[model samples]
Target: MIVKTYQINGMHCMGCVNKVQKAFISHNHISEADVNLKNASVKLQMTNKLQLDELMDVLKNIGDYEMIENESEIHHNKFQLSTYKPLLLVIGFILFVSILSSYKTSFQLMNWMTNFMGGFFIAFSFFKFLDLNGFSNSFATYDIIAKKWKGYGKIYPFIELGLGVAYLLTIHSAITNTICILILTASTIGVIQAVLSKKQIQCACLGTVFNLPMSTVTIIENFTMILMAISSLIFDFFKQIIT
Candidate 1:
């Protein structure tokens, strides 16, 4: 028997693993199939060397699974721009809209930042709402608070929604920034821990819909929000003093 290892895309949970394994084993040439959800890889013992294209054909009917040659390819793929296109496009669109909203008289830094935050929160929360249970499950794997209380993961999207509305409506700026700072600080802490430990987990920022890997990108995303909140508060403080 020949043994082959391949990296799989779209195997998010044990259920996906089962599906993949079933698909492979059903093929007469593959004798044993081991699917690892954590690393998103599969090892197959086959009677003959199966072509990559042939293996992919087996999975095509089961789901949107793409098989790569090996783990190194998977690692390289992670750093590719296409891997993060969804996230980049989302942030880019938010920034574009925020700038348009703030550019009436001139480029207003405070207004742009506020609008950006509102758009960021609302957009991300919308994805979480798409698959609330999936997002909650993924969040609990790494979030400090979600790890302790599973319900926090379920309610996190709503918290983001509320913050987005508060920012957009320009209601009680002080309280909004304070809450934003506190919440994002907590989130950043969890993200930092996960990145530092090199944990291979899905990022729940865009919810389960986008399968984003937990990395420095997540750290930067959370820190950006926290920095903006702090900056807004500082701007408010100095403005009040000058006035």
Candidate 2:
């Protein structure tokens, strides 16, 4: 069973709550619907998962009420550590390999960070490439540029791939790191907006293949890349200064 929480507007009293509950529970996959007029929230238990669009459609057909999903609530309830096992494992593997590789000559924090980022981008882009159409559809829902230009979503994976190769090859480090910083900074804006607005949406980090919920973790992932890029660039600047 899956539980989804949504903030309901236009509910003035118990009468409105009852109607909303009846409308939702009448749906095929929905087992129960509890609408709390006092809290302005509705909790739904469903046998099958449904997208926000689908839920909106259901409410639209019933009445003029607006159902705004509480993404933060859903993030807390639906997505657990187990739900993110695949993502965690991928990050763990990348960090392990990158750290191991960095130990070859000497331990350099910059090298380790760059290697981790290179592996992160390459592996993530691989999944996005697996089903480009699917990934683009999901990414467009939350990414700033991707939402504005659908083509950006289509080509984002390729961009990631290019960045990964540049990082791995150590080619044009300054330019590549600058590009990384810019792209991730823009991406983080959209992520922040989505989370703050409590929009229930799936994360496009691992592509549409895995149903990862958009939460603080997504924000952290983007910021991690941005931080690494900035750190490397700063280190380079200091090295030049010292010389």
Candidate 3:
């Protein structure tokens, strides 16, 4: 009866909590595991043959989350995130600002901003179609929604570009801002999707050049982008009727 309790760490939300759970559930040797985000510990009932080396290997790849044998060393791997998450997050922010910039004093400035946001997204999404392991990989997930909704990954980016173009052509702040905010919201959903799937890989947002860590920065950035996008969406909704 070798009952070993591991000191689990680096869980911030329900998504983080589930990732840890998935890791444990994947293994067959353990009788049961009770993982509490608040407690940050794994209660395992084992038969004394389990090796610590194997356990350590599995924990290291939990995306930004890290596991250490020594409880005191947990901080070393805590909240580590991938670089792509933040990079893509930044790209999303730029698009968001572009919508507001479209509302500048001069109509010419508005046109420039809208074109910038739309054209870039279209180009970026086009190139992204070539990469197999990038954001497109997330679409391969096995959940009901992802499985049922095929080809959806390819539609979102192009749609965003079209919205930008329409807004620019019409010089409609309501439409432009609404579209920008929608993009932001969608990106935030990406973060949620990753968390839910227990995905711990490179975000693949920067086009596969940088191998960054997936840490708390990525999560926080996702949240901030969502907030900004939501504000833009609301303003658009109001502008539509008022103007």
Candidate 4:
């Protein structure tokens, strides 16, 4: 077995690092791999020697980010992430339109539609989270927890539905506050996990619908939700307090 040393570039954070590592192992012949963000390097132990062209191509496929074979050896645009860029843009725009619709119309319909959209986002992420491979990915811990915890996954969609319904059914300040807190708490945990894992990997959050960069978007999107919910909650709370 030849132990080949390769470096992955353009990895800005832990998520970038993990995604590059996955790119390497996606090739079946690779026996093992170890990556370090500190050095921005990847070490691969291959089953046997292979064609250099094949090796380079496979590594490039795993990541649209840059990968360098050696120092001063730069590969430019080995893959195109531009395709996914449009998808993320669409997700953002749709979110904007959805929020805007609520502002322009009756508050009740706004609340109902927004709740459904938000719930659908969470439910969609929940499904992609399940598609994870536990052994290869760090974030796959959710899957393990869901499996052992039993019913967590099945129950979560229902919880999200409940949150949506609560918002739709009543103007309870407490309920809105609860929803905001729940979203914030969950997003905070997601950011913490992504940071701690120290690998660049697809967030798999939006699934195939929106190929947004996993970076801050996931956390940010949830943060926005939490903030909106919190704002609604605060307003409701004050209204209740005044009444």
65-128 per-residue lDDT for model 1 (tens digits): 8988985644664555676788999999999999888767688889889999999999999999
Model 4, 107-185: lDDT tens per residue? Answer: 6743644554454455544544453232113223323344355445445444554665565454554765586576446
Candidate 1 accuracy as lDDT: 0.85
- Residue pairs in clash, model 3: 64-80, 80-214, 80-215, 81-213, 81-214, 81-215, 82-213, 82-214
- Cα deviation in Å at residue 144, candidate 3? 8.2
Mind giving the per-residue lDDT tens digits that candidate 2 earns over 1-243?
A: 456788988888788888888888888768899889889998887544567778777778656888787979645665577878889999999999998897767897788888888899999999999878778777777788988999998999999999999999888889999999988888889889988987766778887677677788989888988988999999989999999
Flag regions of model 1 displaced more than 4 Å. Answer: 1-74
lDDT of 3 by residue, 103-171 (tens): 655545335444555555554555545543333434333222334565655565566556646644655
Off by over 4 Å in 4: 1-90, 96-139, 142-151, 168-173, 176-180, 208-213
Off by over 4 Å in 2: 1-79
For model 2, state the Cα shift of residue 136 in Å: 0.7
- Each prediction's RMSD over C-alphas, in Å, is 10.3, 7.3, 12.8, 11.4
What TM-score goes with each of the models? Answer: 0.72, 0.72, 0.42, 0.48
Which candidate do you rate higher for lDDT, 1 or 2? 1
TM-score of 4: 0.48
For every model shown, the clashing-pair count is 0, 0, 8, 8
| TM-score-best of 1 and 3 | 1
Report the Cα lDDT for residue 215, model 3: 41
